[model samples]
Structures are given as structure tokens and as C-alpha cells.
Target: MRTWNDSLKIGIPLLDCQHEQLLDQMDQLLEAMESQKGEQELRAIMGFLKMYINNHFNYEESCMALYKCPVACNNKDAHAKFLITLQDINHKIELKQSLELIVTQVKQELLDWFVNHIKSIDTRLQSYVKKSE
Candidate 1:
């Protein structure tokens, strides 16, 4: 599981803190999934994310727009894709899918996507973040 670190910072404190919280949550979720205590924990984490992620995305998107960042559209697109993935995960849970499948899905869809988004896509915001500061 990936832990939050300074290397992940986008040069914005609020967004960086939100990203840290998300990384921490993802780590907890992954740990729980690995330990076979996933179902309840997954539900809780999903519930939390359902609320938190939207706010985070909105703030990030707004910043992108305000700064006229070149990656604004890509960031919005990625966020939409992530929301769909989250819905798909919830659907699978509702269908009583195997925990193993859910774990694989989360790892592939959520964890990997998030890390890559940060390192690649979101990193494009660094210049803007610096300018804002």
C-alpha cells in the first residue's frame, strides 16, 4: 500500500492534505481487504469516499479552471471515469461478488488509477499550484 509523502504534493496545501487523506484511506482499505475484513470496511470506506471524493474533485477542478491549467479537461475526464468505476464497484458489491474479485477491482481501478493520476495527470497542476501560492 502506498503511503502519503511530500513527493506526492502538488504544491497546494488543501489539495495536498485531501490527497493525503485519500491515500491513507486507500491504504486502510487495501489492508482490510488483504486481511479478509474487507466487506464492512469496504462499505465504510466507499461511503466515506462517496461524499469526500466529489468535494475533492470539485475543488481540484475549480482550481484547474481558475488557473486556466492545460490539464483541466483531462482532470475532469479522469474524475468522471473514476466516479463510474466507483459505481461499478458498488454494483459488484451489491451483486455479492467474491471478495477476491472486489480486491482485484479496487487495486486495478482505484489504487493504480489514483496513483497514476497523481504522478502523471495531476502533476500538471504543479506550476499553477506554485503560482497560486
Candidate 2:
């Protein structure tokens, strides 16, 4: 249900685009759940997430490194934590835990984290990049 808004833009085109893609994927997963889709659809979303997140984080980290951003370490640490949380969610799903609960957790946690990251970490990166340019 989380949609990208202009307020979320970090003033970096590439990073903003990547962030939008992630939000789109998250929206798709949320829609699938709302539509009462089966596990297969959820699994598909998760599969896409695993690959997309890895690529996005790597690219972001590279950008941070290129600019020598002070927050690079913290950003990477946050990324690792998110990956772990995602894996734990997957494991819970596999264990046949409450689907609704899991979905709610994903909605709350991921959305919260994404928005906060963009505002706090990515915005700082954007400023650094702009200043460098």
C-alpha cells in the first residue's frame, strides 16, 4: 500500500529511480496479499526482493564509496539488518506461521525502514553528491 511520493525523493535521479522500483515491488506484494493470492505469488515477490535488494544496495554502497560518504558504514549495516529480517520472514512463512501477521509485519517494518532510510541516510548522500558536483 506504500506509494512513492515526491517528498521521498532524495534529489538523486538514479537513486530515486531505484527507490521507486523498490516501492513498486512492495506495492505489488501488498496488492497480491490483499487480493488473497496464494503462497506462490508471495514467493515470487520475495524472490524478486532478494535479487533487487542485493543489486540496489550494492549500487548504493558503490555510490557512497565513490563520494566517500561518512554514513556508508551505517548504510551498509542497515542493509544487512534488513536482509536478515527478510530472511527471517521467509523462514517464518516456510514454517507455516500466521500469514496475515507476517504480511503486516512486512508492511509496517519495510515501509517504515524504507521511508526513514530515504529521509535520513539517502538524503545525506544526496547532499554529499550535490556538494561534490
Candidate 3:
């Protein structure tokens, strides 16, 4: 199960909720792959995951902008790279690439990025919020 530990909190309620939803989608994808789900079901999930991520990332970054987070631009670039990588993942899935490899690679990369971004970059934004208040 994906976690929503306190350390992941960025003091933004909406962003935190979206983060939980994204993690839940990731968990569902992992479970589906482990069970060898069919293409149709996977496609449904991919559709939701793609749109949800796009929406979440865009909105969260906009929050940073409103807060005048200095790291917002840098964070947005990282988000862009992630979106590009997600597109590549979609391509690989469409081509029937090894599900195990794809799941492992994607999950690990995602978790690593989440941890690093939350611990370093997101925390910087939190500090900015604190300082601004």
C-alpha cells in the first residue's frame, strides 16, 4: 500500500489529498500488473491516471506560484520530466513490454521521486510558506 505519512504533508490540504489519490492509482496499477490484468482494464486505469496526474501537478504548481515559492519553476521542470516519462511508460505498455520490468521501473522511479521531492523540494516550499506567514 502507498503511504500518506506525516512527512509527506506539505501543509496544503488539496495538494495532500491529490497526492493520496495519485498514490492510490499507483498502487492499483501495481496490483493490476501483478494479477496480469487485461489490456482493457489497464487502459481504463491509464486514462484516469494520466488525467489525474496532469491535473494534480498543474494545480499544485499553481499553488506554489500563488505562494511565491522560489522553487516553483524548478519543481515544475521536474513535473514536466515526469510527465514525459509517463508518456514513455504509456508507449511501452501499449507495445506489450514486460509488465514486470515496467512496473518495477515505474514504481521505483515514482517512489524515489516522491520521496526526494517531498523531502527536499516540497519541504522548501513549506518553509517558504512558513516564512511568508
Candidate 4:
């Protein structure tokens, strides 16, 4: 239900773009679920999500490293936690859990986590990078 907006922007163009793409992907996943697509479709979306997360996290971490952001470690830790949570959800899906339940959990957990991460961790990293500049 969440859409990418200016409020989510961290003042970093690449990261912001990646965030938008991520939101778009999440929307697609939700749509697929709503349309009652099979487990294969859901798995495909999950694969894409994993790849996107890896790329985005790497990019963000590199930026943090480049700028010597103090919050880099915390950011990495948050990313790790998210990855673990996502994997657990995927495992549950693999176990033939109800699609509705999986979808709801994904929507709630991911949307909430992403919003908080962007607001807190990413904003701080952006501010630090901008200050360095």
C-alpha cells in the first residue's frame, strides 16, 4: 500500500532511485499476490527482491564507506537482519504456508521496516555524507 514519495527521499540520488525501484517491486509482488498468482510467481518476486536488496545494500554500504559514515555498522546490521527475516519468510512459503498469510507478513514487515530504515538510518547516512561533501 505504500508508495514512494518525496518524504522518503534521503537526498542521495542513486539511493533514492534504488528505494523507488524497491517500492515498485514490492507493489508488483503485492499485485501478483492479489491476483492469486501461484507460488512460482511469488518465488520469482522473492528472487528479485533478494537481488535488489543485495545490490542496494552493497551500494549503500559502499557509500557509507566512502564517506566514513559513523552509522555504517548499524546500517549493515539492519540490512543483515532484514535479509534474515526475508529468508525466513521465504522458507515459510516454501513450506506451503498460506499465500495470504505470507503476503500480509511481507507487506507489513517490509513496509514498516523500510520506512523506518529510510527515515532513521538512511537519513543519518545521507546527512553525514552531505556534511562530508
lDDT of 1 by residue, 5-84 (tens): 88888777788899989878877777777787746777898788778889999999998999889999999999999999
lDDT of each: 0.84, 0.86, 0.80, 0.86
Clashes of 4: 0
lDDT of 3: 0.80
Per-model TM-score on C-alpha atoms: 0.90, 0.93, 0.90, 0.91
Worst 10 residues of 2 by lDDT: 90-99
Model 2 per-residue lDDT at 28 = 81
Q: Per-residue alpha-carbon lDDT of model 3 for 75-127, expressed as tens digits?
A: 99989988887788788889999999988867777656666777777666776
Going through the candidates in the order shown, the clash numbers are 0, 0, 0, 0
Give the higher-TM-score candidate: 2 or 4: 2
Scored by Cα lDDT, where does model 1 land? Answer: 0.84
Supply candidate 1's per-residue lDDT for 1: 48
Once fitted onto the true fold, the runs of candidate 4 whose alpha carbons sit more than 4 angstroms away are none
lDDT of 2 at 59: 97
Q: Best candidate, lDDT-wise?
A: 4
Which is superior by TM-score, 1 or 2? 2
Question: Scored by Cα lDDT, where does model 2 land?
Answer: 0.86
